[model samples]
Target: MCCAHKNENRGAFIVLEGTDRSGKTLQCQKIYDYLISIGRKCIKTEFPNRSTDVGKLLDGYLRKTIKLAPEVSHLLFTANRWELNDYIEKNLQNGVDVVCDRYSFSGIAYSSGAINLDYEWCKSKEQGLVSPDLVIFLDINLSLSSSRSGFGDEIYENIKDQNNVYEVYQSFSNYSFWNNIDASQDPDVSLKNC
Candidate 1:
């Protein structure tokens, strides 16, 4: 027989994945807040966190102010995640739940969306990073997603790129821990199921 308390100390690593304007940021905040309200130890983070040097490069690429080669940009994005790998692992090991706005999935989808890099090539850079225990993928149709505000700013924010990223996210369904949520529906109802 297993001890019921043995698993209590392993905090959940929850990752929110979605295309641009899919309300991932808001939902991550909501989930984080809800966890806190319930008195659970929680921490929230976002990729391209923009606080680290690697993240600064990613922010520049996203803003289109700096033009790095697609491959190089991809590496920088992966490096940004690597920069946080230790923190995330330690937090979870300490039983602090982590809610991430984006993760390796974003790295793969965004890079593949840009340079048409092989999926494996996009994924290889992220190997050995800790995987989220639960990945909540918010699915928003391209048509509906495009209609939302702030959809046309960055270098890779166009419909073509968004569609490609959506396809890439779909491939993640093979992972048993992935949960796909339809964001086109009411947020409250979606949250209930998420």
Candidate 2:
């Protein structure tokens, strides 16, 4: 069972995003563990919570088991994020920081790759959603990302696709909350920067 938050102020909403092999998950886990050890109130969550019904549909689309139009796929991904909005808001309101593995940026970049969805348009589609207070981008180049172990076999797992997404992510660097970290570094170094 979980306990109530001890702090008075709302908790921070931190998001981890990046190209493949960017160490988002690894860092998130490490951060979660450290926070727990130190008794900081927090909750670790992720987009496409596949246990949920909407996420079940998204799982099929991601796995190529279900054929969806790019537009449909984009909406499903957005819906997947929405599925967690209430929980995220409630946690943050209670002062339990939320570490999210992915959110709107992934939706925008990945969806654009399937077709010609403009970055701004993709951003607009996510209007009214709860934005992350901070977004840590694991910056990894195409070559390095491809060479990483366990590079996925999924639809958006190729050099072209990855590169496309990288470019799109790059385009969003102007945002004040976006923080880019050199993902090629050792885990400790990356974690320190993150």
Candidate 3:
């Protein structure tokens, strides 16, 4: 519902948000591929990019190699998104849609889920970052989520944590720009909704 002002000619800034193993990556890739096929200039990226220094730090934390306070970890995730704000803006300005696998919403939901960190606090940390023109939430239950191929490889992998995260994601259902797709369905059917 928080729509930023942009020129009509600019490409859309799209975000794909969901809990762990919700098929966000696969669906995002499908959206990107379709956009390309239709001749839309576009680029796809994910949060905690894992290529930059902060991202590497995040990766380390995800892999359980380093330990930090929950609040600190959450801030790092928000910072990772801030790190890409300019790039997102640039792509949109140049008429290239920026499709993100995860954005500040995930940082807020996943980090605050079952934690002392407040949703408002986590949201405040990402205030200045670019907001998406469209947010597609891939809705799938935690059981099916854990059944995914790479379910437990990183942090926030368990059913309990994912359940809390899923609850937070549900809170965004009322947002005007948000759209929920049953990710448990066939990929082609899900893509059709996209």
Q: Estimated TM-score per prediction?
A: 0.93, 0.91, 0.96
Per residue, candidate 1 scores C-alpha lDDT tens digits across 1-194 of 01122456878888999999898998999899999999999999999889998988888889989999888988998999999999988898899999999999998998897568777898988888887788999998888978888888778788888988888889888887789998988777777885
lDDT of 3 at 55: 97
TM-score: model 2 vs. ground truth: 0.91
Better of 1 and 3 by TM-score: 3
Winner by TM-score: 3
For candidate 2, the 10 contiguous residues with the lowest summed lDDT are 1-10
lDDT of each candidate versus the true structure:
0.87, 0.80, 0.87
**Residue pairs with backbone overlap in model 3:** none
lDDT, model 3: 0.87
Q: Which stretches of candidate 3 lie over 4 Å from their true place?
A: none
Using TM-score as the measure, what is the rank order of every candidate, best first?
Answer: 3, 1, 2
